[model samples]
Target chain A: TQLLEQSPQFLSIQEGENLTVYCNSSSVFSSLQWYRQEPGEGPVLLVTVVTGGEVKKLKRLTFQFGDARKDSSLHITAAQPGDTGLYLCAGAGGSEKLVFGKGMKLTVNP
Target chain B: EPEVTQTPSHQVTQMGQEVILRCVPISNHLYFYWYRQILGQKVEFLVSFYNNEISEKSEIFDDQFSVERPDGSNFTLKIRSTKLEDSAMYFCASSVRGGRGTGELFFGEGSRLTVL
Candidate 1:
């Protein structure tokens, strides 16, 4: 079983719609990072949330770290076609390694 | 912006053959790492290197797998003998500092290995 569990493994929405993706884990992490990956490429860093209950925003995207530091969520507003990709959530544990969730594939239709 | 670069974007080899995947991490970065993603799976951490030595490694990184910083600019992963299961996309990432804090990793496009 994956240390991190992501809900709604797949999501499809129309352009301009809003959606939220969740990442949950039983283990506490020092920090959590969200990345978006396109086909035939590597994952790109979206944001890193370190403080519990902290919220950060990037343009139309919003990210929040859980109060317990064991979960996170990513919300995209007015989603566009350019927003379509595989969203991955990874947590950095006590070690240097980053444990990644299975990932949520989001497809925004035009 | 400086980014990690990997070589031999795609490779095809037979089982039992050896393969070497190369990566040039972002300049000025202090940490280097290797991760692999099998099709339709999550990215799995293979190993992390710091100060010229392996700082951490996952169970998937076995005896057959080895990493070397042959020179100052390049980090390479060598698979002594490959198996069909070794086919996957391997990514090389680097960070400015070490630890689980604010250091965000920069990754390359990844090298796809196909073991037949």
Candidate 2:
């Protein structure tokens, strides 16, 4: 079975600090997506990276797909209290069904 | 922006009881899915529906679980008999092009099911 392993299961940082979360998998993926979920709500899509070595930016967040397509990363610049949430990385393989990572819980204290 | 919606934000039921969770995916979406997340656990895929049928389902979707798209917009998941392990937040999601292209899945707020 395909699996995505996320790093830094829990992170706590002061507002304005920078942080990075990583997702790795032993299998290749056609595309990878990043989502941020708040309490009592579903995960909100942040970005989807398709091509290997591709990078996309959304305001303070930057997402990168590894050259091998087996890993991905999310970097937050100057995190704010609003950025605190559970971050999840999911990978799409041969089928449309997604394989999700364990997720990273981020806490940005103001 | 269009979004997926689920009814009964929370449902409490006893073990061995039947429960049906309803969802209305985005009107134009062609693919629908059901997922569950146990408390403090990662989200897991339960089933995927397309073209009025289930295209895929996870191992977790056993004999007791069933999915149906009775109409154009509504998709439902029914559990014949609930168990304490079934307690979790069930999410409904939809995508226009199955993520093969640029379209991403839109998920509902989710229905929290507490099986006693």
What does the lDDT read for residue B104 in candidate 2? Answer: 75
TM-score of chain A of 2: 0.98
Distance from true location, Cα of B29 in model 2, Å: 0.4
DockQ of model 1, rounded to 2 decimals = 0.76
Candidate 2 structure quality by residue, lDDT tens digits, B36-112: 99998889999888888888889999999999888777899999999999999999999988845553778999999
Runs of candidate 2 exceeding 4 Å displacement: B99-103
lDDT of 1 at B49: 97
How many clashes in each candidate? 0, 0
User: Which residue pairs in candidate 1 have backbone atoms (N, alpha carbon, C) closer than 3 angstroms, thus clashing?
Assistant: none
What's the lDDT for residue A87 in model 2? 98
List the candidates' TM-scores in order: 0.98, 0.97
Best by DockQ: 1
Q: Residues B1-116, candidate 1, lDDT per residue (tens digit)? A: 89999998999999999999999999899999999999999899999999999999989999999999999999999999999999999999999865455747888999999999
Share of native interface contacts recovered by each model? 0.72, 0.55
Candidate 1 residues lying further than 4 Å off, grouped into runs, are: none
